[model samples]
Target: MELRTRVVLQLAMATGAAASTLQMRWTTDAGACSSNGGQCNSLGPDGPWQAVMVTAGLENADSNSAAEVVDMPMWPAVGSISGVLTTSSGGEYNPFMSVSANKTGVRHDAFGPWLANLFINMTDEGPGYQEILRFKTSTDNSDELNATIVAAETWDIRMPTGAKYEAPAGFLGLGPSTAEDNKSIPPGLLDQLKAAGTITSNSFGLHMGSVALGQKGSLILGGYEQNRALGDVGVFELVNEVTRAFIVDLTLSVETGSSPFNQTGSMWKGVEGSEYGPDVTKNIGGVSGSAAILPSAVTPYIYLPPGNCEAVAEQLPVTFRQDLGLYTWNTEDPAYARIVNSPAYMGFVLADRTAQNITIKIPFKLLNLTLESPLVAEPTPYFPCKSVDSAYGVWQLGRAFLQGAFLGFNFEKSVMYMAQAPGPDMDQGVTRTLEVDDEVILSNAADTFEKTWRSQWTVLGGDETGSGEGGAETPNGSAPPAVGNDGQNAPGNKIGEAESANGDGETEENLGQVQEQGSLSVGAIAGVVVGVVAVLGLVASGLLFWRRRRRQAAKEDVPEKEWEAESASGVHFPGLGIKYEMYAPRVTHEAPGVELRHEMDGTGIGRRSMRISQDMYANRI
Candidate 1:
């Protein structure tokens, strides 16, 4: 059988342009920004950009719930701690008022005291809750030389009584705090951060990290990770003033052998030998309209137009579960393993109003997420493609799509920028602060797509010498590096870390390198060279090469049962423990009614009551 291929190449090649000559100049002295009660420079030679590390883990480490709680980025916050500890002589030793709550509420034993007064109310969507109190908060970025307190919305889940719990993960909201319909809402986190002079502008960027590779993602306020986004950046206007929705002419397609739904006579059709059987390699078509980028959504599903959802479902081994209102993956099918392990992907083409388009390729492995407990009776493999009626205005690209795409929003300018995100194995240290009016620069030399695909192909038993069919060769006439199934590079192919651009506009080498005898690797040196040559041209070839090498590499011959058991044992979905009601259509009818009057007294001032009764009488017309 002949299979077709739809390869979408990068729009622009990387150009050897000179790096930006601009240097970071701080107007104030060292440590002045943090010492003045969280007030710092906003518009100066040094931009007002602050970087926050977003790590992934469970909110309560001791909890036994299994809801696929994976790939959730917890933000940092500052908590107020009053009172002083008494010394042995009954004298106050060290007096402290507040503390930085960085990396708190992740484990069951380290609950932050600031969340004691916060109450969460769950919505119809599981895991997506609203805090009743608009608590005053500040980002715990003391290490970044800024810490400002402002009031914003915080989210968490209410646990059962007597259950041990920690402070829930902090979700930073970047949208407009007040909508036209609701003026009482508090300011968003970005706006609050700007007000406190913690950041330069009310803008932010997000890379949701890669679950397939177990990598931690980052949230940059007033800037973005230069190396995280590749190729051309598509800028779109925020169409919905309330939700910040944008218009994207989206098209979906898949590679050959990527999905079982593309097979002939798949389960999409109930009949045998039906004409609906088409070659699995055909284009799946497109859906054009507005799609909201919601990072706070509970599920990873990308809600799409109903017809487009059906088109994608036709190419995958998924069945529509009416109960869950989602398409569940058929883990029993042999093709399921092949699709995830193979070098196959689902391509998404997002075009702006200017007709500029960029294709985002999502590896099948990232889409192979599991749903447990409340979502399903047992651990079940599920697809993130969701179908919703277009009439309801429910088109949205949730965390599932954000995993492969980097989203940056500038509310002050009413613009949103999108670009293809680098894979988890790539280096992530190339961060550049953005000015209020600055635009995101797209790289012509960064081949993030080709590099990502080549790495995955090599891990799937392909030739490592770049002689395999349809593989892109590196500049050295060799494959990039062999990445294991667990998203770690093979030994000796590790990429080195690029020094972060610090104050005085000068780059700092490893500040605390304990190994004086060790030298930088070829890949690491190449990264620094590229960074100096072109600020945006830095490529993370093997920065985190052996980060996860300790994980047992998955073998092709591994039994399917064994893989299933391993996956089901620890995987969970964030915010799925709460109960929610699925939306369903309802019917209503109107009937004629008659009014009955009763009087208790004869006088006009006496009490009188009137009741309306519906007439059930029907006439044969």
Candidate 2:
């Protein structure tokens, strides 16, 4: 038996120079100009006249894209600190750096995409959480991050049409409290270990000796109070007026750079909520959450393992382990992270924990967009264009990547000690580390991201290195990434539970990564097998029925006995509403697992047909 299936791809490809029903191809220019077939760049330096296109079945980023989180980059270090502490070993203290919290803005999402990019570019992925940052569990050290506050790409702020109402592009900014000064680090931790010791690792790019007390944690410089939706923080960056209204998607890597721990496992992608901030809750006591973060700035974290059994990881949403005297995940387990360092702070500290290997690589990438249409819904009349379906075949696209991520960290150098407050006012004590380097290559993140994805894509292609999706040059089936059901964040940052799809078991489409939260086990992958759908069979049946009817109408009826006794053995219809009901049961094998609905009208019709067929049976079984 021959079986047929229909797979819709990018719509941009359908209207292009190379249009194949199954293949969708779009250009960046088209993405910028049109909502349905393109993507956009949050960072500037983008040219005017750019165009990104989307082939048929391929939804445009403007149409399917969601606002994503990018890494925060430091514009420039305003000040620095150094101290000398004596150790019991009779050595000068290792040099740990610190900066005061004189943070500027905490609510900066109103600025357009350009300014938004600026803010994210300034921040880097910090140290791990206490929960998953263990030095060793059972076998070896592993670098795992417990994403305390689930970060998702959401577009909450909107453009204000008038006064009194906030702009729609508002950002949910939050930060940590305290000074960036480290007072008790053992003098020369890196110098002593490397100058004379038995260890292995490297220094870091961005440097802070301690994690909690000395690192930047969205805290404004010098203790100035910054208004945050939830915790302490200055807004991401400076945004322009136009940017306040436009929507853009940014994908963030959870733990950037390399690893300090030594483990051998992998990580996977999880679904993200598609909204900005969550529903406002008032008056809570038991089990209420603290230290909130902007959903839009959420990203994926890398996973690592521990060899020994003496270290632990911290899991703060906006703060890092370095701020609290803990090690980072990049120095020990790097996977192609670039080694960048500020001359003021030397990197690579595997041998002796001097400065860490500033190889903590964080990446932010932009995809398919056109100039005239940077966003899907914009300044003028909404273009009435033929659109793609709501479903974004992300799994089909995801099949081309490494499929997992790994995080790394150094446990020996970074340690944590919890403390209670003075007079029960409650002093939260955590000290960790985050390194800083002065290598500003905006494109580095994009390059590394593309490289990793390409590597996996190459493997997926089975040794054929043509270079598929998410690469420097356009990918093999280059089209826009998935967008939201409508290019907007989920209602109030709420995540909808998994439910059944359409008759074919499909949920709505075009939902960008923002709405992609859900656990998919590796075990589940082995269980799914391709199956034929009754819808297609019914389509064929309808066409055949139409042809037969047309032929019958065109010619006179044959002799009475000439018409073959109609097959009462099986009942099938190809007309209108009756089509699905008749063919569904005939083509389905997994009905037991499906939600069954009885159509009374259909039952009545069937009873009527059965009565008519009984008359025709006339003595035949």
Output the number of the TM-score-best candidate. 1
RMSD of each candidate relative to the true structure: 28.3, 32.3
Q: Local distance difference test, per candidate?
A: 0.39, 0.18
Per-candidate TM equals 0.45, 0.17
Best by lDDT: 1
- How would you encode candidate 2's per-residue C-alpha lDDT over 464-544 as one tens digit per residue? 111223321111122222223442222333332222223443422412222455444444433321112343466678899
Runs in model 1 with CA error above 4 Å? Answer: 1-170, 179-188, 239-299, 442-446, 453-621
Q: Write the per-residue lDDT of candidate 1 for residues 260-343, one digit (tens) a residue.
A: 222222111111111111110011111223343322322245654434455555555566664444567666544455456665
